[model samples]
Target: MNAGAVGSDDPGPLVLGPMLRYIGETDATVWVETSRPGVVTVHVDGREWAAPTFAVKGHHYALVVVDALEPGGAWDYAVHIDGALVWPEPDSAFPPPRIATMDRERPTRLLFGSCRTTVPHDREGHRTNGVDALRTLALALARGEEEWPDLVAFLGDQVYADDTSQAMREFIAARRDIDKPPGEEIKDYEEYAHLYQLAWGDEANRWLLSTVPSCMIFDDHDIRDDWNTSWTWHEEINRTSWWHERLMGGLSSYWVYQHIGNLSPSQLADDEIYARVLEAASGASGADRVEGSELDLTEAVFDLARRTDRHPEVYRWSYRRDLGDSRLVVVDSRAARVLEPQHRSMLDPDEMRWLDEQLSGDVEHLLIGTSLPFLLPPGLHDLEAIDEALAMGKHGRIAAQGAEKARQSIDLEHWAAFNDGFVEVFEMVMQVARGERGRAPSSVVFLSGDVHNSYVAEVVDAKARHGASSRIVQAVCSPIRNPMPRMVRVMMSSFARGLVRPMRFVAEHSKHVPEPAYPWAVTDGPWFDNCLAELTVQGRDLSIVWRGGEIRDGDDAHPVLTTVASVRLPGPSGQPPGALGWASGSSAGSVS
Candidate 1:
């Protein structure tokens, strides 16, 4: 972990953050992990807001909600633990963290990517995984080389609980026997806390996170590979003795560390668990006695996690954020799934209904953020649909058994795999795009990450009749750190480039597989890279750029970002459908 001490005499109390989380017109939430239970305070513009730390298993954390600030305001903030300043460490190279409120009059710039693994930011780590693109972006932002994004959305796989690095393995070994079940993988909440520290503890990225508000959703790696992929998979995993503890740990930690901050102030106020935590901590004495007397939330958190696991409808991880004229709806595609074999769905009935309500238009743009891509490459989509058909006993019971093994083995559980859900959601999106729900936005964009590749696809009217007024597109950026293996890349390339026609033929011929409501084609990528994507929405115009880190002159410490792809989608001023302006030299291929 990075040092929190400010000087020789004072050992600071901060453990992880002063991370700027949710930001609204007038209120902002700053989250932190302190060494001891204390009242964490944020001082800004002659104003201070403090929140007492709540203990979970021995770790103390607080989310200081700073309110009554001006809309579109930018204020430099300082962190204090029990009246002693702890953040903006002495002689820090980066600028002091600032809370920047949403500016409705300005364009919204959102930076997003996924699947970053924690590793040393040295030459060896770069050689294995390429330079950390997020860190490179952090350096650029610190130097003011790039404008700060309105928000950074970590779509999924923020931490790999199953794929432990050497440091995580060593930490696990020190705590328990590695030869036991759940060996090397994170087993409980404490291990999850350490794993998150490793992921976010890097000085540069931590500073970046401290300033740029972020939102997140979980993918398979957050818990385990192919987690909740299907009912059969769930049943098989439930048979294991360690799965219960692992599930509780993953869910509880996710709730405390990630989900709570995604809420707006009003939503937080309405949350029962958040209310309980604050009520318990409210009675604690000031920082003097807080060390041992802070409210302990271990049981409460675990119980909530258990309840969420049993009945996901009781608690919602999905959330919606309105930014000026645009709306971002982040879906909990992983945990809020309906996993029954007879009727599997990517989202449960409640989540689907909520999503339906959130998809309405009237703004300049509508952004749907799902960890898994709602729209995959046409070939892969058809293949997954076919897999789902076979898995559902459409081709006979024997074939269904074999298809289940293949589904889990190859991770074929995207939207297309849940055909019923895919059709329903696609219809909803079509309604918004067609202006049936409201005034058709200039664009209805799906922002996603997964598949270890980056690409852009434009959804077109399958039948050249009754076309929609809005541009329907899928913009996917993935693997901010992780890179695909060469062989897998080759396979993905074939599926993307060569198999489209053949897959379409098979899907059309299959009796069980229903045809997609709309056809889409990749317009930009299949770029396999450890990269980040930036989407800017100004009025009706929209543009997206994908970039990756490049090491020059063996300078691994300060890698430079190089653009991988750029595309501009024309606004709604009579531009022809599918008209795209690809930036020159923006080629499609592996960046590494």
Candidate 2:
């Protein structure tokens, strides 16, 4: 990325990201949404590229593809929507600004994080949560202050219609005439359109979206918590007639607001309706439909994708990308599940089979991006597993009725909640780990966020796997902005390690199924903050660093390395704490 982005006084409102998607078999598709019909030009390395605009339902979209780019090179692109520069000028209104995009020769840097709340940008700036960390990085890129990255892989919860901010509320109040009450959320097509405007209105974040090549999927908050998890979860939500409208609103909006841009050409084909928009993008003049093609075929695709788990193979929220030798597979943890019965799987079998095909033996690093961590704190993992079994009619009363009510209250449906899905993914990874069919990539790394905390772990030989010596690392980065409550941190620590041991005991004695010997250990930390993880492979060694933004003692600021970790294939065995160095979320002096 050149970082020579020209700033404009008139920064436009066509928000760009949670900038995500991959350069794969399909052309490199850049996704963005505009308020009304207009022309948005995406410039790669200062050259104009293919801009396809379309409308769906009612929203506007732009997908610009920089055709035939090199696999290992870094390409910086600037965006102009209808002649107005989209990213903000240096000294962004948000303060201390952002230091984004670092230039590199190869596919070394991966900037990523997830679960950001779309709270109204506190204009008063108080309770505003001020500047965005990722956006700060973006400012750096726009000003050529930092190097450009190879890619940005956003995990999930890119937008939160379910959890709106004061700003969003205000937006909804004016545009909507709902009689449900003050906090009554958006329910149908029209209301969802308003929600999307609230989520993507910030000029700075929107500009960053325009420039950075991003890849994204959804989490619960993208719609509502625990969406499509089980029969019980589904029943509770469906009990109210408005529930279906609420869900349809969420998913339908998701298709409009986020999912449309993430599609590769092949994925678009699977998206029966979106395929038409892609086809129309090539027409002599109607390609503008990409921006306003909303409320049409795109809306229909969302409805079908939402209402039925029956056509699991038709539209997938999952995608794959190849950057040099590394491969990233982003999964749709929410939509691709077999959540009817508690015993059912999280990933439908067909999706699982497709993933099996995608994970191959060629890459140096294989990153599996899922909003929910594959390996939760063994304690939480087991707890959800236990609840899943109990809910499946294992115990009499609890299994029969109490479990259903309990399921609704607590979040019992992550990978662990749906143990079947959990087991399936675990086994599939192990198969890759054991070098069974796929290319047996060196490190089968699981990149996740949504635990409200962050840590790194490597899966080793469990009693269940017996003698298995594969390196499956789980790297988690969360809340590019939202941090968890401090009180819970203490409890998360006390019950973390010990929780897994008791889980092993319960599984072995009560369930009578042999449990995997607990072999994984946390090497980095449960650090919590608004952070963006930068992943790089300098040479033979791979380094994943978590960066945090900060203000200095003098109140000026800069972005620096908070946590640094490196993984060499067959990494060092007898290592100590500082061996894999560490520093505060901020290193030393502020850049200002």
Candidate 3:
């Protein structure tokens, strides 16, 4: 890893990315990693944009901001490192990477899913996890067999920092004692970088990322399972000798690799760390320098990470994007938690306020992208609310201790587990639906992934008491690769169906539990397939499709994408005419 090799004579190799991110009608950002510090350039439309590389630890990286493009234009692009072509490697089979800008006249299609694990794309890996749905989509896009999405939002768990694969474990064993503290789990920044490289380095997926814009938010597995589940859990983890390093490493690397790319150019410009790095790299700062070359941001990143961890309020990971008449608000559910025992909330006060403002409904469709489902199956939601009550000392100390153990053991820490916060957010949704926030949208949809299964739930207002103008629904897709075990799937199925009546009765009668403001029921599926979902919004029409990869004729190298479920959500007036055959009625019913 040469740190400061100068010029094109010793140009470094492109390692990862040319990942197209944060695209608008006329501008976009391209991120990359390189073997050494060198300028990264993007060539498109007979023009080139270049940015100097910045160093972090021993790693060199750059984000080239390409601007002044035609609105709604599609331009093929190439990457150059120090004036040498490195992208579209010789003899490449796929089409050259292209930048497709947003077009308001066309429908907005978003491809989204979460909880993917990195493994070999072979028979054994497919058997152990499942075929990679994202990879299948990539293959389709590369072959021009499917339409390209305007954006892809990875809801969460893009990497499992705690659950290392055999390859990652081998990488760790070669560097450190895997049997020691932190074990095979990632311990520091360098390891996280390697983990990301492994996750995104696959050729098919890499090409997809290079051509499509993406937005992402981290879930529990991005750091550890059940991360920040509770204050007790937090205190328990902080006591470990390796927790500090793990925390800082996960957060800082996330900032560099994932978070910054999610921001628009204006947002990036306002970021303090981004500003500092650009200033130092451009030699605009008067600070003492070793030749005043590319700035090293390792220490600065760690400082920001430390501050973010200690005071989560100081930074907001949530962001909003308005695409034509639709608004997409991606929320940071995991990190923005208010973990105080007496007043537990999935989001702190500030984050909640921010979300309230972002939930306005002037658009035809309002999409809320949360890593955790805002609406769980009714029975499971009740069980989690009860568990939260017990854990909050509603039944005294002994019961609280048992509830805490149960919560962590079963991963019962979704929005329902934070009962008060759940209700507050629900009220906000209700307000939006009722046209209180603004002109109510045709639909207020919550897009989420997690819980290892996919489903669609719709709010049921039996008497039309709220007079809601928008169709409120929850659409969830999970595990772009990883599949749930048989037993866990059975348990979840029971929760989704068998326990509904009993749990609802218990919840309604319990003194500690508060009645929900509105009843909702799962209207479609509890599908356990490893799948990705697509949401298309064309004017007042909205539809969602879940797709999974199916290996055909034993061709492990290429899996065909098969539709798992398709639903056409009704608008304010009613179901759209000529709806798809599989589109289910949004009638009020008992919970799943």
| Best candidate, lDDT | 1
**What order do you get sorting by lDDT, best first?**
1, 3, 2
Give per-residue CA lDDT, model 2, range 1-592, as digits (tens): 1122112233245533424343552246666666566666766665676454566566567666555554444455556667766633444453222222322235557777887766533433313443346755765666676666767777887766566766566656766665653245656666666655555555566566655666778888777777776786777677775776666666666776667666665666566666666566555344334334432355565567565545666667787766665778888888777766634877888898888787665566778899988877776677777777777777876465766666667666777777666776777777765567555555677899887667787665421353323357788888776665556666666667678788867876776233544346666667666677877765434577766555444332343323323333342232311133334343321110
Residue 533 of candidate 3: its Cα lDDT?
A: 91
Candidate 3 overall lDDT versus native? 0.85
**Candidate 1 Cα misplacement greater than 4 A, ranges:** 1-11, 281-293, 462-466, 584-592
lDDT of each: 0.86, 0.62, 0.85
TM-score of each: 0.96, 0.82, 0.95
lDDT, residue 583, candidate 2? 42
In model 2, the worst 10-residue window by lDDT is: 1-10
Better of 2 and 3 by TM-score: 3
Please rank every candidate by TM-score, starting with the best.
1, 3, 2
**Model 3 segments more than 4 A misplaced:** 1-12, 286-292, 576-592
Model 2 — TM-score against the truth? 0.82
> If both were scored by TM-score, which would come out higher, candidate 1 or candidate 2?
1
Candidate 1, residue 461: the lDDT equals 49
